[model samples]
Target: MTATASRHRLTTAKAMVDGIAAEMERDESVIVLGEDVGAYGGIFSSSTGLLDRFGATRVIDTPISETAFIGLGIGAAVEGLRPIVELMFVDFFGVCMDQIYNHMAKISYESGGNVKVPMVLTTAVGGGYSDGAQHSQCLWGTFAHLPGMKVVVPSNPYDAKGLMISAIRDDSPVVYMFHKGVLGLPWMAKNPRSVDEVPDEPFTVPIGKARVARAGSDVTVVTVSLSVHHALDVADRLATEGVDVEVLDLRSLVPLDREAILTSVAKTGRLVVVDEDYLSYGLSGEVVATVTDVDPGLLRAKVARVAVPDVPIPYAHALEYAVLPRPERIEAAIRAVVGA
Candidate 1:
């Protein structure tokens, strides 16, 4: 069935689970392993209903041991099984860094291309819910920094499902980062775009491709995940004021879509990178570098960045909002770049 024919809308989290379930039905080798993924259906509901749909063998829950379960997923991938491992929170990667960076991300290269670690490390990211420093973080930069792993972050339900299918099908390890604020949870504050229409059938959104969420000529706002929503909100508000702003969502990070970023900047001649990740050594820097590397002359205005400062995320609600790249902060950055 075509996506248009599917009149119903789906949340980003539900779309993710639907995509994984479709893959499991086609391939019995695909399994899910993570804490609460079975019964609880993932802390953020990324795997909701998977356990009952696929049974315990396929959607197996494990003890609160990130290292053991993550390492097990790596080994299983080497043995020709596609394992979808959930890390719960992106900030919890400290507990199993070796298993991810060293093993799941490098086994194929270390094995002289003889071994393929076809696994998906899905996790939740962002800090709008006051999840605190330990539970709130967007560390896609760390995984994208390392080689042999593909990073995919979806801003909407359609991309979420398509990217999940692609990640499950890819031969290399894929890190799927979803922002908690985009999951469409009733308890949390979220954008209306979070519960948009999604295709009923499984599809693939190619890795490394950036999507133009909104088109404009005055300025380009390059971002991903939850920040995409924020940028779009700002763009819409600015459009009414006659300040045209483009919102570019870098759905996949590891492949790093240089062409899309360059194409957008080439048109606008002004850039503003908004990211939930830290200000230094992350997507914002990399995006600015991508432009300068091609041609500094293409840039008409100095690049502006709106990102979290180089500090641990605070636990207080006010502090968290103060640091995150909200719509007001994004609008300000766009104005600075556009001289509006």
Candidate 2:
């Protein structure tokens, strides 16, 4: 909450916690509750040091029943309390479907905009380090498809912190999904973009805006979460070989930035969507539809989609890498689209 010239940097997980801590300090109504979030911090270290600062009452940890805890958060929100509830892993969303999709999300609409559900449902998403099908899944489209909740997926620490603050301040319910790889966890595979300088003061990144991480004119690669880093890496690598690949990070999903995708696709005239989510009926397809539905003539050549096939994520490293939309696959898609 204080301003200083000294730059403070943090991993995506820590930066997220920092934003929550700042909001808690600013408003007494804001509180956090999730499994292992208090004494143990978060499984991904998203709530590190919160317990020491806020203590158990405000940063309480609940039992493993996600449905009960999430329902409790909804009740708190209805009573004018801003609650940040963690769902641990996105794959576990199945257990709390009625609470999430029916209640937490639709309360505002069902109440004719009179009731505000100011709650943040945060969860870890994406797959890469052999977490398998159950634990590893980027269900971006799953939450985005449902109306009522604003879905945001941050690819870096700065966005992570800013988005957390914004989600907390938002009057409606929000689904905040962070990728394990981008959390900068010690055990997960290293991601250079995961850690970055976040401001000491509180700030908010507009919920629906898309950031053009890499500017290019030859090809456009639109993605969200960890895939943004991969697209940027692919953009950098292909730049050396005369392939200009633009990378668009869809920081927020519920309000999909279709105009940004259209602008990039129109400028590049060749599109490649790299998504960690499934290849069908997800973010990738939605992006393609945005361009094609507007004007297919904008494309100079046929596009390529680099995304996980319709299959469960395998536990083995080799098999997992085979399905993940890695930098190599992104580079290949861009190269082929550019006819390089």
Candidate 3:
């Protein structure tokens, strides 16, 4: 079974869950496991109706033991099942880091290529709905730092569906993050009722490839997850002021699509990375370093990063917005980079 060629209208979150469900329907080896994944459809309904359609055997619910369940997913993957484990929230990943980074990620390599763990661990990250520090932090950097794992953060529904498919099919473990903030945004939803032909097939967008969402000749704005939409918003607002900024969505972080980053940087000669994670030792920093390391002379100005402040996410709404990178801040960074 494959993705239907037919385009459908679905909320970003709904589309992602549906995409995973579709994959499960297509492949017998596919199974979903997590607390409430079977009955409650996951904490966010990202796995809603999966158990009803696939039955309890495929969409199994587990106890609230992250380490045990995550390890179980890894073991199941090694034994041939494609397990899609829901971590509920990114903050909970710490409890199972050993299973993920130490075991799942290294099993294939440690076995001299004899074993492969094709698992997908989906989790939610970021702030906006006031979920607080623990539930709202973006921890992509931690997983991206691990060499044997593929880190994916989809900014919209289209990318979410495509990337999730890729993650499920990947031989190694993949950490797929669905940002909580952008899930309900209408602009990213698929048009399910459209009369256009939607193919009844399953397809995947290759990992490590970045999409140039909005092309421009001015400074390049590189970002991923919720930042992509924010950057695009800022780009639109900046356009009125004659700042034609190009927006590149760094869809997959682990593969680190360096070519896309380099090309965009080479074109604009000015780069601003807007990331939700902390500025220091985050994806933003890595991108800036990549550009300068590749060709320092190509830059017209110092690379800038608009990111969450180096502090824990605050519980207060105003304080939360203050720390998380906003469109205005991104615009400022872009302008600073381009000297506009």
> Highest TM-score: which candidate?
1
| Shift of residue 268 alpha carbon in model 2, Å | 0.7
Error (Å) of candidate 1 at residue 134 is 0.8
lDDT of 2 by residue, 169-199 (tens): 9999999999999999988887788888988
Which stretches in model 1 have alpha-carbon errors above 4 Å?
Answer: 1-4
**Which residue runs of candidate 2 sit more than 4 Å off their true CA positions?**
1-4
* Candidate 3 stretches greater than 4 Å from native: 1-5, 185-200
Q: How well does each candidate superpose onto the true structure, as a TM-score?
A: 0.98, 0.97, 0.93
RMSD, one per candidate, in order: 1.2, 1.6, 3.4
Clash pairs, model 1 backbone? none
Clashes of each: 0, 0, 19
Over the stretch 118-177, how does candidate 1's per-residue lDDT look in tens digits?
999999998987778888889889889999899999999989999999999999999999
TM-score of 2: 0.97
